[model samples]
Target: MIPVLALIVGVVLGVILDPTVPAAVEPYLPIAVVAALDAVFGGVRAKLDGIFDDKQFVVSFISNVLVAGLIVWLGDQLGVGGQLSTGVVVVLGVRIFGNVAAIRRHLFRA
Candidate 1:
């Protein structure tokens, strides 16, 4: 409940504020968002399964963002930023979809 509310508030604030990304950090933003969503969906699924841990959720969220950013940064250094960013998105998208599927099953029993 709190997480969902926070998400809503954050989205509302973001829309109202229309924050701009720094040019240097812009390339990694989308990958970080995807990673964060992957962690969020996983946390939600874990909550539904009765195994949600706040500590684990925090760690997962932070680590996902950091690691995804790191991977993109590294790819930039290697001149393969586009490819690595795509890979990160693909992997995280799979995890997000899997978690969402589990959550849907739990919620709807379908």
Candidate 2:
């Protein structure tokens, strides 16, 4: 339920926003990576936090996002924005299916 609601909210936000908003705001966006990291992390206490301490998780998450962006960027650089978009869509489809399966298994147990 939360996942679906989140998706719906994201879709609505995207639909309502200017398509150029991300680019327009990109220069102003935080470099703090994930929101949770920005919200609760600071000082040596934050450094000792388990989530921040997990180097592998941070690396993996950053790599995944950058790889996806690089894919699109490469495609655009090579005059193939459509190809990059298709690649992004493909990954998104697979992710959505995986999320649905996991939720069904965990929540429905059938």
Candidate 3:
């Protein structure tokens, strides 16, 4: 609940502030966001499964974002940035969907 509220508040603040990402770094933003969300959903699933660990969650969150960004950066250097970004998004989106399904089953006994 708190995390969700914080996310909402953070998004609201970002919207209200309307800060812009630098052009150079903007390409990696979507991948990073998707990776961060994957971490979040994974954490929630872990919590629901009674194996939640704060240290693990934090590490996973940071690493996911960093690694996703790194992958995009590497792809850009290799001239395949868009392809890699799409691949990352698709993989993370699948994971997130799986996690959500698990969470729904856990909560609703479905």
Q: What RMSD does each model have against the real structure?
A: 0.8, 9.8, 1.0
TM-score of candidate 1 to 2 decimals: 0.96
Clashing pairs in 1: none
Tens-digit lDDT string for candidate 2 (8-106): 897898798836636733522222123223222221223333234456545655665566556656666798856765766565556545545554555
Error of 1 at 46 (Å): 0.2
Alpha carbon deviation, residue 94, candidate 1 (Å): 0.8
TM-score of each: 0.96, 0.49, 0.94
lDDT of model 1 at position 10: 98
Who is ahead in TM-score, 2 or 3?
Answer: 3
Off by over 4 Å in 1: none
TM-score comparison, 1 vs 3, better candidate:
1
Sorted on lDDT, best first, the list reads 1, 3, 2
* Top TM-score hit: 1
Per-residue CA lDDT of candidate 1, range 68-95, in tens? 9999999999999999999999999999
Question: How does candidate 1 score on lDDT?
Answer: 0.96
